[model samples]
Target: MTSFAPDSIVLNRKLPLWYQVSQSLRASILGRSPQDPLRLPTEEQLAGHYGVSVLTMRQALKELEDEGLITRHRRRGTFIEPGVQRGAPVRLLGSVDAIVAQQSGMVAKLLEHGSSPVSGELAEYFADVDEVATYHRLRADERTGEPTNHARNYVRPELAERIGLDDLARWPMTKVLRDLVGVRIGRITDTVEARLADPETARLLQVPLLSPILHYTGVTYDEDGQVLDVAVIHYRGDRFSFTVTLDAD
Candidate 1:
């Protein structure tokens, strides 16, 4: 039997308790399994485990069933759908892990690559830096030709000329930061916010005008506290999500 990793699941207070529980359960279901009939804990048992009502647990299970990740028979218990483990790639975010793509079936299409002096709100992020410039802009799509994400990347002015569009299309910015700029990564900070898609953002992401979007901004800094790169990536709210792990003080 596959044991659940209790420590890996935490409920987010920002969302409804049922939604949070459903997401937690969904992660466990994604792991590959070879058991003939995978068995999930009873609704009452799960409710007791999570300290929520059985009604809340049923709601969470309903979400999984609606997504075709689980099935409930009249007499037989719930089981994970046979082939769901191989579904669309799930995006996971972490401080050290960064972006881990199982595979790059998603093709990158460069839109515009140019350089301009940083201004306004961006100036605060790279404080005391002489000059910053835009390095790359691209949108990515899945093998099925669905838009996945749109990203705008920036780097120090000194590296603007060295890092070109081809480089952006080939590999991730982390590689460019290490090879081109010669900076040993120390830490990464990520901030996620919700926003409404604008005209340009809508076109790039293929989302409806004014649709909900996830705005993610990350800043990479070296050991000396110097900012190395700044990235602003947008993900479709429906097709993508992020997982964050927090430890209690």
Candidate 2:
């Protein structure tokens, strides 16, 4: 198990502080490996991370307890539920290598492959190209067949030509880009948000409409800082968790 820094949490002032804090803690718990210890940081330690008062931190933790995500014992500290770590898929963020390693265990189910006009916001990734190759894919745990992520990928035109459905089904997009296209990825940027699933997203992920989901938009940049691809993924809130690591060096 890796060290978890209590002061690493960053809150978004745009949403309720408690809601954001709860989600972060939930991710930490769900992301725990089976071999990892169940005990979590104390309330005071956790509160210090987000710069929140003890009462606010307690409220955030209460949310987890109500969801059966964690258990609290006096003098024993808070601990993740015994079974929670085994129930959901945990994806590590913060590094390309970590993401690739986690993704290798999942199988990609190709939903659709075709060309589509990029959104205005996405055009920047394609060097202002209006249309690009698009792939709709669903990733599931290979053993359990449980869907974890639904993703739409928009590839730069020339790069897209070399990639086909077969490539995506067998390898993660990052792997395909690195091993097949032979492109060196210099940077990866990811933004995550929690939102209610729309009808289309709900259908693809097999979750109820309006259910909470984790939305991620990730961009891959080449060695020269050129954008190579953009991926938009929807992860089932209950089925997925993210572990992000920070280095102090």
Q: Which candidate is the best by lDDT?
A: 2
Model 2, 191-249: lDDT tens digits are: 87889999998887789999999898889899899988888899889876665644353
Assess candidate 2 and give its lDDT: 0.73
* C-alpha lDDT of candidate 1 relative to the true structure: 0.64
lDDT of 1 by residue, 1-249 (tens): 554332133444545667667655664454323443467777877888777799998998997898777898867777777654222423443322224222122456777766666777688777777567775455454325667677777777766766656656645576567655567777778788889998988998788999998888878888988887888877777766666654352
Q: RMSD for each model, in Å, please?
A: 9.5, 9.8
**Model 1: residues with Cα > 4 Å off, grouped in runs:** 1-95, 100-105, 179-181
lDDT for each of the candidates?
Answer: 0.64, 0.73
Superposed by TM-score, candidate 2 places the C-alpha of residue 135 at a distance from the truth, in angstroms, of 0.5
